[model samples]
Target: MECVFCHIVRGEAAAHLVYEDRAVVAFLDARPLFEGHVLVVPREHLPTLTDLPPQLLGPYYAVVRRLAGAVQTAMGAEGSFVAANNRVSQSVPHFHTHVVPRRRKDGLRGFFWPRGRYPDAARAAEVARRVREVVSADGAG
Candidate 1:
């Protein structure tokens, strides 16, 4: 109940709010990757992507898409990075998409680089099954 984003949505805390509507709110990130980095959050306090209702996805992503373009245009960057992290690296407990302006060699790294792999097909299938269970149980499969 003490989520920072929840406080922002309720206007209990100060935020440089840039956009808001019936479904979502967007604001400048206090700690940004760059000056124009923004966090677009749904008004409802869904903890992560899996918790977001399917019907709201379009509206949520519409804001993300708009923010991506706006961040790049407003910051005069060559491109933008639009991303979300779930429980692993999500600093806040609520769902939010990061729209960050980008330029060549701007120092953010690893999206294009290769990552560590699973040991083999059987091991991979086991992992896939685990993920599939969550998605399928949620009626998303």
Candidate 2:
């Protein structure tokens, strides 16, 4: 199946584009969390963040960072929420980052879902150690 984001990237689908360049494209979300919500995607058809080539990482994030500030300024928002779902909660498979304008007393909670604290300090330390071990193994520590 053809990805909808790919169509948008190729100009095969309609989207309210806010920014576009050779490497990335930014457009308004059809169903927004708030009024100034935008979605930024790579021009390529990479399915997930892990699939994105290392060479494109810097360029991709540069656009995302710019869009974060742009959205906040354009919408007169006090802040912004920038995030991307890898695969689990991703509505579209294409690797895309959401930049949503934010303001105080916006009614939105910490996250869309409930939050929980770690069972204990030991558990938190154990989890951090496990993650750090993997990062070190990957030469990313």
Candidate 3:
């Protein structure tokens, strides 16, 4: 299937990219549920977590953890949620992790999500690179 997330991973679709490396690519969701909601995706485009190697899982979730910290610091988010929707709510048909920056009253109620607007590209890129660096350095350490 021609997945939109794959295109974003391939750079065919313009995304407000926050992070990228040989193993992963992360960017802001175009229609986000929160201001700094980001997606951490594998470059290889596995369709589900079950398809990922057990070893790869640590690095993958590591990326998510680093970004969550960045999201909290950068966006002043009070809290956050990270998830991967496989059978029930996978919108892109590719294995990707969502790192959503949450505040106390962001109105993200019980997984009944709402679409939030995308930020400016320059700001997004800056945030993305910062997040990428944080995750990359942590991965290296």
Q: Give the TM-score of candidate 1.
A: 0.84
Error at 121, model 2, angstroms: 1.4
Model 3, C-alpha of 94: deviation from truth (Å): 0.4
> How does each model score on lDDT?
0.93, 0.95, 0.85
- Candidate RMSDs in Å, in order, are 2.5, 1.0, 15.4
Report the candidate with higher lDDT, 2 versus 3: 2
Give the per-residue lDDT of model 1 (tens digit) for 17-136.
Answer: 999999999999999989989999999999999889889999999889988998899999999998899998899989999999999999988474578989999999999999999999
**Tens digit of per-residue lDDT, candidate 2, span 10-112:** 9999999999999899999999999989999999999899899999999999999999999999999999999999999999999999999999999988788
Worst 10 residues of 2 by lDDT: 104-113
Model 1, position 96, has a per-residue lDDT of 93
What's the residue-level lDDT of 50 in candidate 3? 79
Candidate 1 minimal-lDDT segment of 10 residues: 108-117
